[model samples]
Target: MVGLVLEDWASPSRATASGGEYGVLMYCAKIASRAGHTQRIFVAEFRPDSDTQFVSVGIKHVRFWTLAGRALLSKKGVLSSIEEARMQTMLSVAFGANNLTFTGTISGDVCVWKEHVLVRIVAKAHTGPVFTMYTTLRDGLIVTGGKERPSKEGGALKLWDQELKRCRAFRLETGQVIDCVRSVCRGKGKILVGTRNAEIIEVGEKNAACNILVNGHMDGPIWGVGAHPTRDVFLSAAEDGTVRLWDIPEKKMLNKVNLGHPARTVSYSPEGDMVAIGMKNGEFIILLVTSLKIWGKKRDRRSAIHDIRFSPDSRYLAVGSSENAVDFYDLTLGPALNRINCCRDVPSFVMQMDFSADSCFVQLSTGAYKRLVYEVPSGKQVTEQAVIDRITWATWTSVLGDEVVGIWSRNADKADVTCACVSHSGLNIVTGDDFGMVKLFDFPCPEKFAKHKRFLGHSAHLTNIRFTSGDRYVISAGGDDRSLFVWRCIHAPH
Candidate 1:
């Protein structure tokens, strides 16, 4: 969950950063910085029953280590001088019965090693590169995931007996696309596989069919996310050009549709029947929530649409663009947009906006550090304290406000705190920041340097965050990681 850039040789061990990675426990409190690829260390494990014996596998290198007191002894794995075997890169390793260590290679072969010496190489263990291997600790079986030949369909989760003979395999294709398995382990008598597409699927021992237990966005910067006005489901749109609908407790992806455009912002209509999607191409479209049919479409500007909101009364739609304009559309005039006046004279691009409870006004926060209020139909800026103070917002999502002034640190940049959402009960406000932190603070926190609770489980910055209908859970979307996290509400008594 690191937000900072990756550095080489930072720790003497020069361990590979964990994005192109997974982690496991090792025997040594101190690591032996052995030579391998400069960027990645794939897997490390302690040999069965011996604290002194350890194994590590990575690109083009596999090493067995012997720890004696403070002195760590490492022996580079030996492979036969076969011209092709010399080029094989080890990606996964697991221990077998009687201390035999099996390392999966880039050429789909499993090299069996007994005490640092290469014993035998099992050919065609997989079609493509074997990315992961798990020993069914209870049974003397090895599970490997990779591609299968002939058909070339990837994501082959196969089980091999003690003799390394193939027993069975399952290719878990998700929605017409083969999902490559990233890691594998056994759980509760079933096989649990974590896929490269960010899905946790469980396979039945007897049935080859796999059930997806969890799923998420796959590509960078998932900026568009909005909860259903009254239901437990939520929608997320991403740079991958996908709009996925997911449920709360089930954590299952209910449905998804790709509109062929990278969506930047999304909002559910107040009545819950329509969804408004703002895209990277500056076009915003409305879709019928249930059928996902295009209800309306518009490309009012050429720049990206930064934000979109539907009035609480469901009569108007507001679209804020990177061009520093907020355009209004009358929803009451049917599918065709009745172009109302546009709000201008703002200093910078509109980053966020919300309508008043009565739908007469909208408050927008811009990139240039301005939070301005504008009358809805007239599109006139309002400055009078008496008028602005009396407005009740339908939603509070702006990051720049008197209430959220504490969210910014004295040294924080404008992009540091990207998104914010207040709770339904108005008890607290949660924020997503560039450093991948989710912070909780008192609502309307005007005090300078306000105290807050920080939660870190996302990589890079969070693009968007929203509390579900009851404020029972918080959904946070990642920027570089393409991960969506759901956090439960744990508020302290005021």
Candidate 2:
């Protein structure tokens, strides 16, 4: 909340509404950006106060902050004439030799500055935007990561000497997507590189081989996730056009199948033989879990499939879509048959659902905050209160269920709670919301504003969450942060 409110992060116009008015505070002082596009602090470094006190960099702006008595003050960095001609928003800042400051720019250039004035620019220091840099005197050089020379190749890495003039560049092993580097770190006799797609790589010194230490969805939001029926494996489908299987114990991505079309939802069968993936193009495909090959594919309509679920008995497949309908496929005869039925008549698009423990009924939560009940296979709406109450659900994901009515805070909007999941033992619940919070609540939280503990990590919206197979941990995905987090669960927390 450092920058002035704007229409959006990329906009220059100020917003009419402010976030808060210093609630729960007696007195406070703050400073905000006065002019230019919205700026988000990328990095803040602490150093002995000199002509350059504290340095921070962000979108299109750099500010040198200093302590004036008890008051904090910041001055904007001034670009030189030539520097202004090829201006780049600073991406990273680091302290160099002789009280000088160096900043990496979006244009792949490095700017050497004295105090608040730009001194020089080393052009094309990197092929694309320089994301992160680490300075180490042990190596007597600054290590940087950015876009690779060719977009298809991996990111560009550089080791710059003290003078900031000459450097050595390293090429990462090529991958399908452009490896835009997001982080760099000094390791034991090596360098660690983190990419935008969540791949963690290790490179040995000078012309040596690079090893991929970790892997994930190369890019895009990951909304689809499924836990293996009885193992430590997790299935994740991302808009990166790949559905990846990850080993939860070893933190290694095991196997992946590229769907060409971006995938949005995924579900592993209760029998653990195959998985169903829903794509952004409204198509749904079934793939063998072991080999990662397409078992079957179909599309009932051409709209993004928001969610897909397999019944606990492994007899039914339900695909929820943005077209305001739920497509049902009878899998008892094997998934290659005609559609059993399509459930409709919801006021809004389908958002989430759960099948009864017996697979005879389903509970649906629509985008409009409506919770409705439907009979499975027949696709017929179920309105009898007695029947709906007696049904035992294998899962509890719909946000609007009566048993979980206490999850909603007073005056909370309908769309605030994006996702919720129940632990296997049915003793606890995990939920994600628009505020990027993952909260834990007691099962069947029926009291208004039920007591809960919130953990914050992701940015923007946390769109999905689920408990691991053993109920030992929970996995959550951020819609905007593009990050998947795993949290260990505590059995008892009063």
Candidate 3:
């Protein structure tokens, strides 16, 4: 695992020139594997006498692949294959009534897994990258919208049956990129499609023709579109920093409100009584559904809001930001916006977050490498040593001395560990490395680790690593390989 070290010192020479003291902060990060390699070093000087200015004198170097001079680990896994494209646009996880979790990758594949084991993979569901996916309420049919490939004719809106087989495809004439697709209601036979050119096209399930096309936004591209749960009303937000509500059947604008910042995302509460708008300027506002008035507003100057979601009970709102902070607000209390708790100081930006079915916990994932779980009301961390327990088998050499350490120091060179996860019991840990390998390690291993096993399936950088709820298996995903691997935990305690 990579380590960060920081130190501060007083620069006597610089102090003498300015007739005052100045501090120099030194940050050193080392990626020590079986092979000796230096990754990055950063140094900053702070001068408080003038304007408290900070100047940096360091270059960042990142190694995405393994270094040379090391023996490769043996391949290990029950299943391995290429399943999707190189680039992915989105990912959605849905649960069935039977407790089965289905993951749909925007690379145009819908995969069904049972406890980290791949049960099925629906290949080539769309001709190109899928932008949005939704399941209908009647027969659980999946609706997908995406841009067509260059070889293809135009963009498509497709519907899949219960078994994930393509049932119908709708041909669109606009030929614009579909940014968001949503179903108006259960068994309504009407689907709403938002395009990058700020147009909202309503299409019917039985026919391939557009029912209505409305210019949703005038200034900028539409970022989000949401439908009301019980009414024919829908909401759209755009880069113009405005949120507008429209009536579908009436084909007219119902209300409009400007948020004074670029509106990046919007969502309506499941109860249909409130709406949340996330802005790009680190501000978010809550509006009343009936009166369309601002209920509350808050801001985080560190980063912009990326996504917003409400708990299953519609009582708590989870606001994820680019600064790795997740704030939970209690909606039961009035316009004061009582902040129940917050999960802050994470390692990376919070790309997506979801509340548990019971609304007791929230699960969040970052852009590159971190997955965290925290209790809702108490804001207590549920993941035990997730970041520090990651163990990489590599040969790490000391810069000033001849000391060498790591799990594979005796046999192999070095590997770059990308992501990691610890089991709920805190007895085991799983790590994904740049060589597309997933390895399991015994927690609290000796300095020269001896107990470890490898799971090899991906042929690219392993971007994600996760453990099943029961810690029975490990789920991993590759970065450019576009493949999802499910490995059975052979050493899981029985």
How many residue pairs collide in each prediction? 0, 1, 7
TM-score list, all predictions: 0.84, 0.81, 0.35
Better of 2 and 3 by TM-score: 2
Ranking by lDDT: 1, 2, 3
What does candidate 1 score on TM?
A: 0.84
lDDT of each: 0.80, 0.77, 0.54
- Residues 1-494, model 2: lDDT tens digits: 01111112111111222232222336666543333236687887754335436788887788878766655677788886663555568898777756678899998889888878888888877878888888775555788888766543234777778677556666676455444788888756688888776777788866646888867676778888888878877788888998888776676677778889999998889988899999999999998876777788888879999989888878788999999898888886775746888786867888888999998888889988889988888888998898888998898888887788878878889789899998888877888999977777788898889877666556668878888787866777777766667666655434
Candidate with maximal lDDT = 1
RMSD of 3: 24.9
Q: Candidate 3, which segments miss by more than 4 Å at Cα?
A: 1-213, 246-253, 384-494
Off by over 4 Å in 2: 1-90, 113-121, 137-139, 151-155, 165-167, 174-179, 213-220, 332-337, 453-456, 492-494
Question: Where in model 1 is the C-alpha error above 4 Å?
Answer: 1-39, 81-84, 148-155, 173-175, 187-189, 249-251, 338-340, 384-386, 490-494
- What is candidate 1's lDDT per residue for 1-494, written digit by digit as tens? 11111122101112222232324446756545545446477888886667888898887888888888777778888876544556368898888877788889888899888777787888978877888888855687888886555345334688888778788777675565553667889755688887766677788777666787776666668999999988888899998788899877665688888888788999999888999999999999999987889999999899899899999989899999999899999988988886788997988999999999999999999999889999997889999988998999989999987878898877998788999998888878888999877777778889766777677667668899998898877788888878777766754444
Residue 173, model 1: Cα distance from true site in angstroms? 5.9
